[model samples]
Target: MNVIEMKTPKFLVGIETRTQNSLEIKGEGKIPALWNQFFNFFKIDKKISSDIYAIYSNYESDENGQYDYFIGYEIANPDKYLNGDSYVVKQIEVGTYSVISPINKISENVAYSTWQKIWRMNAKQLGGERLFHTDFEVYTNDKKNGQQSLVNIYLSLKK
Candidate 1:
């Protein structure tokens, strides 16, 4: 894990939907379907590039509460994506973040397990209090020969 500061705000252009962890566990997740829509919209996959950004924002409360989740690419321009109705644009404000690459070979179970640890973590364990503002997951397309997923999670922290 590494701690880093985002000196400037970043923008993402993609699709978004609201979801909660508790709802997801109850087989009521909208994220999986949202990803499908993303793939259809972007038409790019691991065979091409898995370099995508998953943004978690608009937190209603903590981890258990509903939040807006977005999956898209970092971009300098938002205007190009504005023409589409399915597309949503977001700006991530400057903040300190803890970067954790929980696993090399990512699976659904392991990824959630990593988050379980984070949810249980307090300020001391996390090295700082959480901002809960704009946590994100970076999906890297580095895996070659196969489609093994990657979990490079970024959690927002206090300055």
Candidate 2:
């Protein structure tokens, strides 16, 4: 494993909306189910792809649990609105991030371990107080195609 120090720029992504107020800083729970709930609440036709991209807070813990962060998913077209919706869509700005690339089955462990590695590297971590600036996981395979997947988990940092 390699720990790289990078001064990352800001980035944007498209996301599905969610009804529940619970924010998922870590990708611990079922993702597909969450997406289903988001789509159902928005009443938008489900997209064919099974991927979701959004901006979120980053947190690290000893027990490997959820973090206290507020996340707003990026919608494709902010101008377009669904019925019965009163929430406003906005763009989330993430400052810097530590991108961790790991293989499929070992992604979770790898992500946490990478945080430790970062801690050891003499750089400042998010430190659990303020919400993480950015966090994301990249899946490089399709479940339907039976292809091997590689997940790259990224943790955003403070400047």
Candidate 3:
């Protein structure tokens, strides 16, 4: 559980979709896979080739148990995302986010566990159900000692 607290001035939205209690979120675009393949082929640092993302879910809960619609985004290098021929790329509004550190790429268990910790510790301080705008897990293709090569978790906050 390698954890780091980061604040990005702005990050572009990547993907938007729905998710449940699943721990690991799978790859949905070719760019992400391509980036991973490129790094592995070159045996280089697990860095994203471009900015890539997938909106994971739309429904989020508030403090009062009310439902709010939100979108998710996966962050990656902008250059890699532009060069990939795998999926259609779209530009979205960028916003500040409280970013989490990379986790062990073990079945996305790191993502689920990080979220639980965030909800338990920071949820109260963040805001209401509207605060659940969206959450995303960023990944790069690298297997270090069978651990995750590149990845980050981001949560959209009310700012």
Residue-wise C-alpha lDDT for candidate 3, range 1-159, written one tens digit per residue = 222334343344232223343312334424344335434542212333543343333444542232221222333545555665442333333454556664445363554566566657554444322245555555555645654355566666655
Ranking by TM-score: 1, 3, 2
What TM-score does structure 1 among the candidates reach? 0.86
lDDT of 2 at 85: 42
- Residue-wise lDDT of candidate 1 within 41-98, one digit each (tens)? 6642222244788899999998979999998877776676677786787887888888
Error of 3 at 15 (Å): 7.9
RMSD of 1: 3.1
Alpha-carbon local distance difference test for all models:
0.80, 0.43, 0.43
Clash count for each candidate, listed in order shown: 0, 2, 17
The Cα RMSD of model 3 versus the native structure comes to 8.3
Q: Compared with the true structure, what per-residue lDDT tens digits does model 2 show for residues 1-159? A: 223344433322233333212333344444446456555663333332444343344334312434422223434554554333444343435344556554445444564465455445444343322224446554456566576555565565445
Off by more than 4 A, model 1: 43-50, 143-148
> Which candidate model has the greater lDDT, 1 or 3?
1
